[model samples]
Target: MKAVALYGTIGSLVLTALAAVPAGGLTRPDTAGAGTPAPAPPRIAFGRCAPVERLPSSVECGRLTVPLDYAHPRDRQITLTVSRARATGGPKVRQGALVFNPGGPGASSMHFPMYGKTERWRKTARAYDFVGYAPRGVGRSAPLSCQDPAAYAKIPSASPREPSAAFKRQKYAEAKAYAEGCARKAGPALRHFTSANNARDLDMLRAALGEKKLTYMGASYGTYFGAVYATLFPGHVRRMVFDSVVNPDPRQIWYRNNLDQNVAFERRWRDWARWVAKHHKVYRLGTTPQQVLRAYDTVRARLGHRPLAGKVGSAQLQAAFLKTGYNDAYWPVRAAALSAYVKGNPKPLLRQTLPQPGGEAADENSNAVYTAVECNDGPWPRDLRVWDRDNTRVARVAPFETWDNAWLNLPCAFWPRHAPRGASQDPARFATDVTDAALPQAGAAHRPVDVRTAPGALPPVLLLAAERDGATPYPGAVELRRRLAGSSLVTERGAGTHGVSFGTNTCANQYVERYLLTGRTPARDAYCAARAEPKPVLPAK
Candidate 1:
């Protein structure tokens, strides 16, 4: 669930008082003084946004202040940048605010609503104002910086497939250094970058928008965020759609979840290999899955020795192709790149993997925020040995992502060790603390939501995921289905794309469009047989 950005595509409510308690009665009204009404929502004066925010001119932008710590609401504040595109339909036809997050607990989502202008999304745009906001610690919303952009870009790139002991140690040191950098630069704010706070900030955004209830659409990690929102503000939810959902089981809150992603990614990697093999006439990488994999390993090994144009090393090559596991829309370009490279032309491969000068440095913010949020959200293994052992074991079977992902997350092992309440004081103990009750909160610590809400307490949510999605994986949707009793699951069978709704999967998009346009959902789980894999158009000979 970590990335620079995700593209391609890729719930109900309300009842009389006779209905069951909202959010299974788990919600707590914003803490208020006796006989005092909760505070009024902050007024967000909409106006021109800075050009750097990258929003369309027609979309207005504004900022709202929310407490850095809801527990001490008045003590510290942070700015949240929000944007809106008015519903295309008249007010009479408009539903309400439809806020969305484009995954990446760290990715900038200010431009997300712009997708509404596209034909496939025009209908949803007509029905609701397209609302978007940079979640806390992301983009223009009080952005978190842990290292100089230039320094981050220059950090030594290590091959994900390296299995040598020296490589593991090197990665451990780098992760520790990264964690230290965040703590040094971010200070107390680092500990406060929890997902629970993100959910709380979202509720405030809802109030500022003057919406009586929340209508939301989220993909990848956004689904997890939405789940936390529903758990904390069940009464405020009007409707929701969770795409490529993360599994919410306490045991897999995140650390184990990433390991799970490794196996799934390997599966998708094979899927891509098979596709390339099928199109051997075009790519000519191979004629069988095994042959294609050999071609791929050969390219990686060659890059390992002499990086293409001294930029795309084995590390960069793996990173570029990893996108294929997230969405096969990347398969053709990436497949072609490898094929061209194998045929002694490195230009296409380099084009696909090299970062523009000063571009990768900007990714520092995303990387910083991603680590801060994930580490703070729940407990991580305090011991590096635990990680090394687990990742090594998984690497044998799922080599594509195991070590790479291990390095991405190793920072959590050295995160600031002040565990939330109920954790042990020892830093190592805090890291290994697996308190089921304190799993998956948006803030410091909280219990796993009793997602089984009473009738009418929560609307029937819609969940979308490809059967073979590597990022969030398919089982997550099924597990989420079990947790959210009234929810429906739409599976795109045989597909490996992470974001499944708005891409070429017409059958899947039909469900998405229908549920968003009208609050209708299948009574039970649904399935959409996979469409044929995309055919690559060969370039002129």
Candidate 2:
């Protein structure tokens, strides 16, 4: 879940545009991935959240104080904002807390506990107190900020076409500047803003919540967070559901993962293009995928010449179109917008791409924390030449997002967390065989949080994945299934959406709900055919 609005590589685009852990083997430090368990904290004094939170009246919120760096639990502390909606059913039906995290290493999920209010989730709501939290370095939890909103907004967008030497230099300069800004603002604290630490914090939260075993649901990058938690506390996990899973291959952790996303996004783009083409009678964009693509290219190129109403330019065009890859729900509106633009009305496209007023701070904070988590998670290439070469190559085949994603992650090259000594930093090795069962592992310091569990060490994990998922590709679910013993995958075939279970797809949702409600899973892997694509939004003319 690393393709969000504005900034490309952070997480879910739709949520940005619009808008855990384990049971305690308490009183002890984790053997592998966490720090010493903190002392018992006070019960979360639930109260009304701010109006800005948009949480339901039943959803009460509170805060827990936790160690900023788990290694020294006695040192600097930070506040973790927590929210809860208690189980509606009687004691016989209660199953403790069921936590939710909706991707973005930076996405604030203090509002997520309210998701149970929806009809699709009401059954699970009756059985468990839906819990949500803002992880360390996110909203209301010692929020992180790297750049000035004004400065960040002014930062130039990556070129849509093949980059020239001058443009590449500009991008590197921007990346270095962005990196330096983070170092200047957040300083050494940025190192602790990591997935490993996030997992550690979740364990602390679990202990505080008094849960002996953790039951959780995560989407996109949240799956990675869950995987890390399971790796660290396998015995504490009661049940889990990962929707749109992140690939857990040590070799693909941070760098190679983005490269893989480029190819996947291109495929999803084609899927959207084909959908648009089939509706040519209404959209008039094209009658074939290639022609639809040409229409997109034409609009992008024309935007470079003249931004719509002086707001949406080529880069904005790309960002708007990028959401199409994330979910087909955006397809009709997007197709209509593009069609409108081609027909000489830029207002629809303008409405789609313009930034919301006063939302700049949230955007800046999201990008800052995203870079901090990714850069600190593992080693990235230290050299720009390496990035230039790899992104350039990927751009040839997956041009839609390759360079754009490259620019989003460029800051990693200059991040304060340097590659570990003696760790494998070869991006190429992982590129060729990312899904190989027997992958050459990186050093302990550089590898992804070791997620492999001893047989039966963990509970049955249910994976919900869309076949053509763009943000967190489908293969990630497959790899995660292999790593987590007894895990079952319910794949939504031919679907390109990022998150699956919450959508209209009853097939995938059945597996998720059943597993959450009864702790049951398919005997083996299962499949769910995706529903038909959205019909054209514009009326036939």
Candidate 3:
């Protein structure tokens, strides 16, 4: 449920297991053979990082190797590329290393360390070295890929809103073929790229980095990864921040999330449409939100028949405007493009503005990893029949992304993964009690962060959200704060951005800066007003 800078959520989300899990389950035993001398505590071999063009000189890059499967420590190994932008004032300003994840179970976040050099993050930046990595099967970390790259496009689109039976059938075939590609091509990676494994990999890196506990910040899907890490290794967390939180219910981890996003994005798009309507003189396309929506529909319909110079089509337009639901910052530029297209001007429409998933050179790798992680992260109904029913039911009320998102995750229904042994039963006296650290698993695939079963109290962590962010709705953050006892939630009353921490909202970022440097949690949940909305354009010459 993620697009770069945009996103995905769940519906009918309930507050499941909010009780703090009792700490101190026996530390998971090492997997080395009984006779094997504990494999030398894994260490990172640091060196000059590759791909210097996009990276800052101050950041050092290195690789860390971890078991392909944690249970078989001596088996196949995978290397993760890690980068660090070190703190400037040695012991004086140095607090500790801060890890950052930019989300996308597939996004390459190793460069997040560069945020330390930016003026917006610089103050808090001086206190600690910023570290980031491309998780397993992502970027320089043994990236995952599908067998047929073109099958990527075979996945359905949002055109026509309601899907026909043939459309659903084609989606099923493509999704299955795509999943088979991952199974055939990804090998060991297909089995181990789950967030649970990501959490485990982070622990090894923590030990290698010599940090007693992890201080971290994650957005979008990263929030889910962080929650899983917190649940699995609560004792190792020092301070953390979750920005634009992800839905945490194990049952709703992703399938439910795709469905929920349709409703949320429609609401977000409605807000954008009204904003455009409020300044109707500038756009000249609408006097009411409905008119603005019709204007957008006109653009989509025109593109469907004849693309803007054969580049921007209905698919590209929908993909780009998805950002409107993310942040209002994109409103004007995108609105201008729409207006220009309406006036028989195709150049602006053709210009590369938003990163359309289909516009780029075929990228089966990133798409494959995304599906692999999401599908394997939890159970997706394998029954292809369920796809038509749920999506058809959802499209009736929320037609926006119902089909596109359904196809985006459709590959999961056909993902080639068998449940591990004891998938339903606890592995090692694992939670005979539902309130134990094992938490409760719908099965081996449902890996929700189990707070009730997680051991020990978490250090005071901070969570941030926009009251109306469509990408990851605010309720997820509220639920997280309630479930995780020591967390504080900072709200931007109507900021409307997906990841709200380091952007223009000084109020929200301040809490992040304060917490990272001083371990300060707000007295309670707090709120800050949204920045002034951008005014419409002046009369065109």
Candidate 4:
């Protein structure tokens, strides 16, 4: 769930007209000795139906049948759930479809069509059908579920530090057992849950919808889904807006990303501690930021020795801390809870949500899919020594969240299936071929494409980054923009949350709305300044 953050100082904003390059220039020639080029995708058929079980009259639902594997179309088929909000305006000026994806490699998009009803979205909905699809292994589609909900309850919230050697042994044993349980229960579909497969499925949806191209807005983990789809079916994409981009480096994997996330969160926590220091009366830890930090560490260390109230152990505390780092909105709530817990009044902090037991089935499903896609797309360090060294270094610098992240993904060490081989990374094939003069010339130098996979042609994409995001640091977003050619990045300078859409900032909402409504892609990279005050007002009264 880690994502690229959108932050830092205001960079120069310039607009320019980008000339569309020839299709051949954007795509790599198929070098494989091919008998003949594959034919274009078939035209799709559509039909209307009554509203889905619980949706409003305005929302319509249908099912699309897609091949289980594009490579073997006749082999098997799977069902995909699709929802739509029809255009509301009188006469359509442009006919198109706008697809939506919410993060949660596991979250459902069943109700996403209703998002089109928001005031900002109303303008775009006039000429387009706002579409939402629940991908395979998720809601409405054939879902992957655990047989026992109670089993999830027993898994225990992440407790990275076992009090005794016996406890450590038990934790590792339990993690391994859970992994085996998934292997036994998840069936063959588990191996097919990689993101590349998901991307293929998305293309099928596009073909099924009878649309010549795909227009999409994806958030959080959704951004990666969009990126993968764009990479695989570039010609099929009309416009794409990837908010809170995920790092595409497959080597880092989930575990390494989480380790980086821990460090980022700790830095943000210190910033919050400083804010708490200023308002000492509301929730006083200490008068200075340093004192607040020391106080917090003392409380964490104490919990390490003995579980708070004989229940909230050091591990649970760490998990809670990581969740708190997601949004600035939760900082005060977490601060108050931490202050009370440190004072021996742990009831307030006890409100934290614990990962359910046996719930590892769902968690594993999501985690497995996350890892499978990443691992399949590229290789990872097969060496345990490398992980040990990295974990040790991460633990020293960012102790609070590191170990918990390690344990959350420790199962990857013994993943049952071999990592999938991917095409070599060819930056030119996948990204735009714009020269330096076309790009913004400030900030960190963009990271070279690291994955050694065959690059596919990708369409022009709109990337969104939030300034204060703790998980995916802002630098990651800037780096992603640099690597992705022809992609325009819109920075939400002050938005503190990870995902940019769904009521974050008007600037973000307006920019996205304009693009989706009129195909008015920003002339160049732009920035959406963080909202200075609540309830942004329209231009003038």
Candidate 5:
């Protein structure tokens, strides 16, 4: 699952109030020629939702059975769990459901509707029923899982470090074994756990929700999901707000994206390091970015031989610091942990990261789903030599996360290529016609998405990007906005956070409120300054 979060800075829309469209209507032209939707599926059979700890008591949950393969509607079925919070109707008729996805490709979003309960969503919650659902093979939706939750811990993550032939063999073997484990343990879902499949399932969900057009807010990887859905079912999308946009470059998919991630994370780390160095007197870790990174690197080196709490290894230590890459909020906390560990007390970093023994390890199912989607979404270079060369090259410059994220997705190289019926869909080639008899062939490598068939005119789509987001960087929004006509690009000028919308920046959230509730996007592409930097955190007592 991709790491995600809130808040970033810079985008200005003329708040010179244009007459807000009737809350129910959008100014976008009709989608008449786009295509027609299938008849509404049997109204979702709503059942009593057992209360969950965080969800509102009145939020209802239901399950919808969708074909595992849209190619064969009668084939095996999988169910997705959906949750909803009914809008508090005001003077106007409700504007249908506002679907949400918190991203991950693995994060359970059953509680997404809870955003409506928070003040962030206060201005617009009543305009639409907020709906959230666990996408296929994710939390509570016939989850995809592996046999070993500790799989990642057993092997060292791919290293940006130059590896010997022996290390290469070990990585290859581990990656192969990990992929096989998913096939054996995750069962039959691997073949179908793809964005294309999920996009189809979402259409079915849209049908079940009784909506001819869909309104959605998808973050991080969820934005990719919505993109796939829009590409697959363009006519059905009414309004979409994509936040912390995932790179939709058909050429990058998972591999090159991770390469970009290496560059981004190291850049973000430097940002944190500089910030730490700025507050050098208070934390006393270092007085320059180089010095702070050296101190941090020293701690990681020590963890390489001795894992903290026997669970937080060098890789785990780096993972713990990733929050700082997402936003500055965790700077003090991670800085404190880093400061404490370097000063002979390792407990704070341990408590902050691996709270319990083995807690830092990824959950079995989560890792499994992360693998399922990334691997299945597109083809990976299967040649170990290719991987070695590319990774060795990336290490020379963008070294920090190059190998770690590489091995994170390496399982795909060895994933079972032969499906029970045939090959899986060719993500590059749009599934204009899916068929059980002749599903797209997934060769060892595939081509980039054909832009000739890219998504077309529709509603004015909105995209949110931060100036320096590590996970889903800003360039992605540029590429996507070009492809999605009438889409407006909004930048948080200095916001470093990944998931920027509906969070800390009043300006960004205000834009979201305007678009989602008033059907008014920024008058033009806009930029908002990031909120003032958060003050340093006081170390825990």
Candidate 6:
């Protein structure tokens, strides 16, 4: 249920709602069917949400009216919000527009233009207009919301078996209430927010920009978006860079995916505990890993019955624990905080704020759009018994996170709507008859842009799995590369993190940058070595 990016506020509602399925359950519609070829790119028609005079000269913002359904281009229209920062160098050097997406099925790309200002990006800044936008049902675009923050905050956390059946019943009731609340508040739009629609919108954006092709960069969930776009609009693509790619296998749902994360974190937690034990002088939890782990579990168990001063409860603890897997930089801080809480001072832990609430309106908007899209993309088992069996199996191996993840996604058990049709089981077949003129040349160089069609397209995409990644597992990356036809494997070595870009190794950064800027992929699916922190020098006395 943890949102994936800075736009976490909007995404939290949808992710939490959909996280109930097993891994790969949210497969999007295959792009293989007959549909009219996409229309030619549209000319730019700039319009302002606010007066243009008040806008900053460096930013160009506007809205474009697109079809609510591409199949009926002349029908109902919705306005999509967009923003751009023009290239800093002279016009002669401009390379065209480069669009960016920071992963979140729901994240806003509206601020992506600013990334060009960074030292790494500035090198390429002179050549392209950096573009950003809010996806449908997200920020400043007909936004969604739920009315109650307290109601959402009160959702119970996962816990161990309790003495009474009454307690378990209360927990179940709480989950049901949250699901019902969302259904009552979110209406029709809740059924329309699929990834396919978003992809269609991206193509529409390409048209409005007057570009013959799209050049893009996407991360995490954004990678999935980029992949689908390539499948649907292969000809319109000039170049694409996807980092920390999500596997496209259809069986793994968001909830099932968390089970993989839980197992990964359990290993990481033990590793952290061992380190804490070795440095007992700094953190006096214990002098051995087992002792320190016991101490940590003791704190979790104690909070289950009585929350720490009514603020830091088991749910909050689990949320915080899950967040630790996102980055190694957070490990020591989290350990210190946990040690402090176990020793009876809970203020630091309690003070950690939850993601900013989108308020009732935004929550309903997000929830509605999320369900509309996710449920429509694939079919989830409607039988509670199936979930019961799957979750029980998962719980046997990953006791810490399975049930909590299950309850987080309980809304799907009673999802108010269903997808238009069930997803196809077979991989979609590409039409060989589609003409070359229909496809744009891969770049100025005439290289075929369809990576999937190349011998290397199925080659191992450099998988940067973090040792302690909680949302997506390091092993998942390994498995993904293994499933890929010619993939070679690489580890972050010892890095414990989520998205590998901006947060970890310089070596990893260099590898990714080289691939993006020069298309020089790692020679054999290499792993960037882990970066170790430098030891502090004590004054020589």
Best by lDDT: 2
Candidate 1: tens digits of C-alpha lDDT, residues 1-541: 4833456220111111112224313222233331222244566788987898767788999998887765566656889999888899988889988998878778666876788899988888999998888888877788898888887877225584666888777877778788779888987667667666677677788888888788998888888878877766778888899988888765575787888999999999999998898999998888999999988887787778777777778888888888888877788888887777777777887777887675654488888888887877665677566676777788999987788888888877777655453333233444343333433232223333333455555788999988888888788888888877689999988888778788778888899889988889986689998867777855322
Candidate 5 per-residue lDDT over residues 36-152, each given as its tens digit? 232234678765675642466778888888776543456577788998888877658588989887777676677777777788886678888888888887767877876556544
TM-score of 6: 0.76
TM-score of each: 0.90, 0.90, 0.86, 0.76, 0.85, 0.76
Query: Where does candidate 3 clash, by residue pair?
Result: 9-257, 21-452, 21-454, 22-455, 23-455, 23-456, 436-453, 437-453
lDDT of 1 at 120: 82
Model with the higher TM-score, candidate 1 or 6:
1
Candidate 1 lands at a TM-score of: 0.90
The CA lDDT at 226 in model 2 is 84
RMSD of 5: 8.1
lDDT of 6 at 272: 66
| Tens-digit per-residue lDDT, 242-345, candidate 3 | 88887787656667777777778888888888888888878787989999988888778777667666655677677778778877887887777777767777
Tens digit of lDDT per residue, candidate 2, span 281-345?
A: 88999899999999989878877777667767788778778888987888999999889878877
* Per-structure clash totals for the candidates: 9, 0, 8, 23, 14, 31
> Cα lDDT for residue 57, model 6?
52
Tell me the tens digit of each residue's lDDT in model 6 across 115-223: 6778766756777888888777776666544337455555334365222356545655665565456545655445455565676677778778876677777666666
Which ranges in model 4 have alpha carbons more than 4 Å from their true place?
1-54, 90-94, 145-148, 155-171, 250-256, 298-312, 342-345, 354-368, 371-377, 419-459, 532-541
lDDT of 3 at 323: 76
Off by over 4 Å in 3: 3-41, 147-158, 353-363, 420-456, 537-541
Among residues 3 or more apart in sequence or in different chains, the pairs in candidate 2 whose N, CA or C atoms overlap within 3 Å are none
Candidate with the larger lDDT of 2 and 3? 2
Q: Provide the global lDDT of candidate 3 against the true structure.
A: 0.69
**What is the C-alpha local distance difference test score of each model?**
0.74, 0.76, 0.69, 0.57, 0.69, 0.55
Better of 1 and 3 by TM-score: 1
